[model samples]
Target: MLIFKNLGEMASLEYLYKYDMYFAIFQLTFIALLGYIILSWLFRMWKQYKQLKNDKASAELALLKSKIDPHFFFNTLNNLYGLAIKKSDEAPQVILKLSEIMRYTIYEGENETVLLKDEINYLEQYIEVHKIRYKKTVNITFTKVIEEENISVAPLLFIMLLENAFKHGVESLTNNAYINLELIVKKKTLIFSVENNFEVKENAQTGIGIENLKRRLQLIYPKKHELLIHKDTSVYKTQLTIQLK
Candidate 1:
């Protein structure tokens, strides 16, 4: 206002030349203020864009994780149904194990992470449930060496690999089938591997489980984890290493 008043008081156009310094100062100040406002607005928009992208990613990951529960329960219930039809003595124990697994899936699966110990227990229960279904036709072995008990891992991460192992390796085998799994944790790294004998058929199509697991791993672990799968003749093997830190 003071600058404007000074300019207004100068009646002659020639007098305006003497106020060139004030005019230059005012013009620079206005441009600086305008630039600041525009930059601030752009920054705010960029921040919101990143947040929305993250939210969408999180939502998609949650949906994928949710699919695992129903798929697992469906298979488990089918096993129970088979046992019930046969009136097998292991039916009751299978039911109990299923109940425990369901409890973990319903409660702990909702969490982003669970204690490594709890996850291992869940896997043991899952393997036990499968063993009851397979009986003497299949041999399953699980070994683990844990250097730390207090570690945390994403829920349901390893289960898909185990599921794939049983589905492709032991489910259709009539006799002499075996699955061996090992888990080793050293410092901040965890290594899980599963190997099993499978009878490969002509034109066997892959299932959605592996793709789903890959997508989940990409979203959760990104570059922090490694998954390797190999098949040779009748043997299929997979190994996954995750960086816990």
Candidate 2:
């Protein structure tokens, strides 16, 4: 039996024990809540950073593809002007082709991916436009074998190679200038090969377009693409392979 002179002087060990336990539980709950909040904030920040990086890449690619060479448009326009003055029967066809090319470049080129067939058609149109501008005979053969259907690719991925081939190969040589291109799509893979004869001794394999293409491949395809270049005394050959997802 115990008797206390003052009731307030009595401190029960059981009550003290209960208080300690509740204080510890409260502390743990508070720490857990703080940790959860911090982690959630970090996760949100990481997601925002990733999204921003992707958006930047997309913007850069759009700028790159939208640059369809102002010189090309100027020359085509000047040529069309002359043809129009002469009332040439081919003026309408030329104008139509030009319009189609512009439409595709302005619209479809901005897309992340486009149909392989559409890209092929755009390439053909580009070739036709170039052929019309030159008086010299430029033998260009583009062959394609697409076994896989509904395939998609990053837009304007191969135009730089074609542009480089013509700029260094066909434009410099006076005779026997040729560009041969082949595209093979099979087994969920796309292979594009270009071979051209060049006369320029230097700077045949270097250009802004090709450099940008390299950057783009790194960004878009990463490990899924392979680009190979072969050069000899008078020929430049390149092959690009892409693994379709």
Which model scores highest in lDDT? 2
lDDT of 1 by residue, 82-122 (tens): 88998989889989999998898878988888998999899
Over 129-197, each residue of candidate 2 has an lDDT whose tens digit, in order, gives: 888878789899999999988999998888888888888788779898999999999999999999999
Candidate 1: minimum summed lDDT over ten consecutive residues — where?
A: 9-18
Give the whole-model CA lDDT for all candidates, comma-separated.
0.86, 0.86
C-alpha TM-scores of all predictions: 0.85, 0.88
Using TM-score as the measure, the top candidate is 2
**RMSD value for candidate 2:** 2.8
Which stretches of candidate 1 lie above 4 Å from their native place? 1-18, 69-72, 85-89
Residue 147, candidate 2: how far off, in angstroms? 1.1
